[model samples]
Target: MPDSVGKPRRYRELTGLRLGTLVDRLRESLLFLPTVMLISALVLAEFFDHLDHRKIGPVIPERFQFAPEVVTVLLSTIAGAMITAAAVVFSLLLISLHLVSRQFSPRVLRGFWRDRFSHLLIGLLLSTFAFCVVALARVDVAQEFAPPYTVLFALVLTLGSVLGIVAYLDRVIRQQYIGNIMRRVLAESLYLIAGLPYGRHSGGQVGEPVTPPEPGSLGPSLVITAPFDGWVQQISRRGLMTAVPEGTVIRLETRVGAYLTKDTPLVTLWPPPPADQQHRIGQLVARSVVTAAARSMQHDIDFGIRQLNDLALRGLSDVNDPTTAAEAVARLGSLMRPLLMADLPARSVRDESGRVLLTPNDLDHAAYVRHAFDQINVYSADHPLVRETVTETIRMLQAASAGLPGREAARAELDRHLGTSRRHPLLTQAARADHFRSGDRRPRWRSATTRTG
Candidate 1:
């Protein structure tokens, strides 16, 4: 039907395929079959060499026995095969890790050692089984064919080398290379997706009522304006007017793109109008009302910035002084919380029905407050203050939970805070509610707040 729906679906499918390709590449590299073959060959060669040196009879005399020159040739061939196998395995593992890490999370690959342990053990078992099968097969071929006593030595060397290589490759792949490559790929992909042409697709869904702009279409439609007539002043880009005009300018009370209300001025005739000029002023009185609202808003913003800067400076000054720093950090957290709360994305806190509204400013303020708390935590990781703040945040979350008429959310936030130790009271509160005693009404907590002087 609509191109809007079709385009997003197509993009998603392509993105999914790209991710799958990455995973396939990773699996091939990490689990190359050639490596296994080389490993088997190396074990076989080592077993024969050990048997010959120990004067132990071969398990397969006719097929495998050789003179000194032939033994030298065989050993060289086996060595080459083992090296080839290792190279193949390592190269594939590196490439796969690089590609998969780019498309997905590195955390997903965390348990590689544990997961691959069973496979390695199975490989060892199969190698032993194959040796036994060969021994049985060679029983009628020659009297010299018997069990190789050096099998134990060969087994150790083969398994040890494989393990060492795997460990080295795993470390190099996961730690040094994969994460950086993956991060870059993900960032670029996200940027590309965001840059794609998608027309006026509102994040808002259908059936929502859109609020239209206020009436009076053209130039300032109001008649009666501000009582104190001044020159035209600074106007916002969006047409919100501020009464901060220069003294020399004298023009109409209204400008193009300015909003008109019941109290907005109509004209500013040159020279002074006598008090007797109140004759036509009655006509101007009934039109509109536009007060100086922008000035007040600007003042509040400036004041807020100044206060934040001052608090930040104070905290910095007390950095070396633990006690003072703690107090300053706490204040900063309190101040920043409101600012962050005011800045959060409205959609994040809003309910599905969209009836519940949350202000972006509130969210933003909360985030800043959380950041301040994080700084505090970092500063006091080994100190008692961290525990104190953690406890305080829990208390705040508890209060919020109680206010909301549920302990579930508060408990979740507390648990999350315990794990992360990062500040963000609302997040902690929400996470706590979700995690702790999901349906339990009573506030159940084992840890008591340890007071810090």
Candidate 2:
């Protein structure tokens, strides 16, 4: 389903994403930064205009104050440079997007689309440019006005924008590497798991009771139909909990990743809704659900894993780049390493009063294991580099999964992989794992590992 895991910080950022309202989207738009900077610059100019009457320029430290002409020159130069930098940043972003799509997967762009750093960096550059323009205009209008404080502030912003662009470019460069991309995906998944209901360090971790609603126990089911068509990206558990009467059990029929159609069974309320409250409650419940044209990692942990798997599959395609495929396995290992000690897929949400507000279908440890490695395992056959990397990664995961729900499964998978390697024609005619253990060079599995490593 859509919203699987999201941290408190990310949840706040997500509210800025409006599925239906253009105004909310505008608030979060990159152009909003320049708009704010223009308005602020005008306001600050007026403030400095008033301060100019109070002899503020002479009061300002001599080091900070510039002559009126010098201030004009500084603002003009910074403004022009920022315009050029903004154009360059925009071009680089487009080029990188194309490169990643060609080399990786187009689906990976969903994660980047919502990247806060990218948005903020673009906003910063545009804001600096807008502020400089406004400041320079004000200075030009005033025949004798220096606006020393305004000039200093503009200078500071210009310097910050310069340094920020450099750092942002570095980040973009690092993201080009497959390993780095996987690491980012892993980090997002970790944050998502950490932010789930059961993720509170104060509460019990993985072993918490996770029983699904029994058929008979769930009272009369009232199907809530979808109000519109879209993917269920996020569920506002708090909104749903607050709207439904206390003690009402909500059985969600739709999950996070499902594509909804008009009249799709979204959820089924227990005991059904009364005549007067039915329409009103349905509307409220619908309000709490956020739908998007596409899936997002804001709540979808599996989507992040799916991205890595896509890369692995890409590497295994006719292109036959085993090294890239191996990178995906290594990254998955890095992602699941922390999962070895943590639980996932929160089954229920509770309010401050400790009432069960919502229960959505969730992933268990076994499901997580399968989802992370299964597809890659299927595609990695015949490619010894990808296969051995997977085996070694699973070995690392098996060691990490001790006392975890998926420990036995990981161990079994590890043994199966080791045992199967001997059967591979590339490995040997003897379907025994001891070939490599015995230091025989009948197969070049070691070389595959070396190249990928």
Candidate 3:
């Protein structure tokens, strides 16, 4: 069960169990057993000393008696000390269990307990050996000996040694185990927090219908027109294509089914409508047709604006170098030029008196437009504008192509455009900016124009 803090309550409960088990196991282990037995022997010895009138053979010494007051004080002090040691030992055992659980896998808890048992046994053996040595040393003082006092002192020393060993081990284990566990938990939690995805889904969600573009939007809309002044394309799915005026040429780039941009060409034309069915067609169809075109164009304009903005903000010369003031200026130039040129209406130009004159005609305008486009390209290339604009455009095209069908040629065109501008001076500037400079060293040539000019 989760607690108020969201951590599993079972973990806390299991931790308590581990602590309880550790105390019980330690008491049964050799370390505690020897101490218990030694204290018991000391008490028995004191009891014998209290039997004042008891007589034994000549081999037994009479000087071994413990005074009643001394016995009472010794037993009381020893009992109090034993109780304190037990409490300390219990606390140590609990701490040791917690440390072991945190440092090692839960699977290793058994091995850890086994190791503790072994250490306890070793301590007990060492205590017993020391006691034997002390006993031997006192043999020479047999005439003045109080066996009960000797036994009690030995028990106290042995218990102190065992408790000291347990305390030291507990401290070391707690430090190592707690540190390791805390570090691991912290790292894992951070990774989970960073890696988990959290967001609202965009685009079409499950069971949601595609929203059609709004009417009257200034966008590229597709209008199917009569080709060759003939009747509409007789297809079973009449609704598949929208009807338009006869002789109306629908812009291929305009949104036929979806929103389009003005840059798209008119690919299909419609002939005059049949006189017999002309009266039946409603004016709303024509209006819808125009609305579709406008919406398509609007979408294209929006897309273009977004592309320009992104280019202006994100375009930088190098992946490593922070974007500089110069790089930003170039990116803004790239973004602005397209918008300016896009807003201008189509014009026809004629060479007259060594000057160009403009007129409005659909035909014979390609050469002039091409020449103008070439001039714009040359100006952009010569200027210290965003060099990465071309590269970004190509990347976007490539990305778009990956999703679009039958756009291999468009992708190829974009690739060619990028290839031409890849060696532009702005790109070179970006590259130079990215070049590593040691310490505070700066580049000798700060501007691309200096090299080109």
Per-candidate alpha-carbon RMSD to the true structure: 24.1, 7.4, 29.3
TM-score of each: 0.23, 0.73, 0.22
lDDT, candidate 1, equals: 0.36
Query: How accurate locally is residue 155 in candidate 3, as Cα lDDT from 0 to 100?
Result: 56
Off by over 4 Å in 3: 1-273, 279-282, 290-298, 301-379, 382-385, 392-405, 420-453
How far is 169's C-alpha from truth in model 3 (Å)? 65
- Candidate 3's TM-score reads 0.22
> What are the per-model numbers of colliding residue pairs?
49, 5, 26
lDDT of 3 at 234: 14
- Give me the displacement of residue 353 in model 2, in angstroms: 11
What lDDT tens digits, residue by residue, belong to model 2 across residues 404-435? 65356555554444444433232222222433
The Cα local distance difference test for each model comes to: 0.36, 0.66, 0.35
The top-ranked prediction according to TM-score is 2
Candidate 3, 105-213: lDDT as tens digits:
3322333344454354344434444443444333333343335445455556556656665665655465444333333333322332232121010000111112322
Error of 2 at 17 (Å): 11
Write the candidate numbers in order of decreasing TM-score: 2, 1, 3
- Cα lDDT for residue 54, model 2? 68
Where does candidate 1 stray beyond 4 Å?
A: 1-30, 33-38, 41-119, 139-453
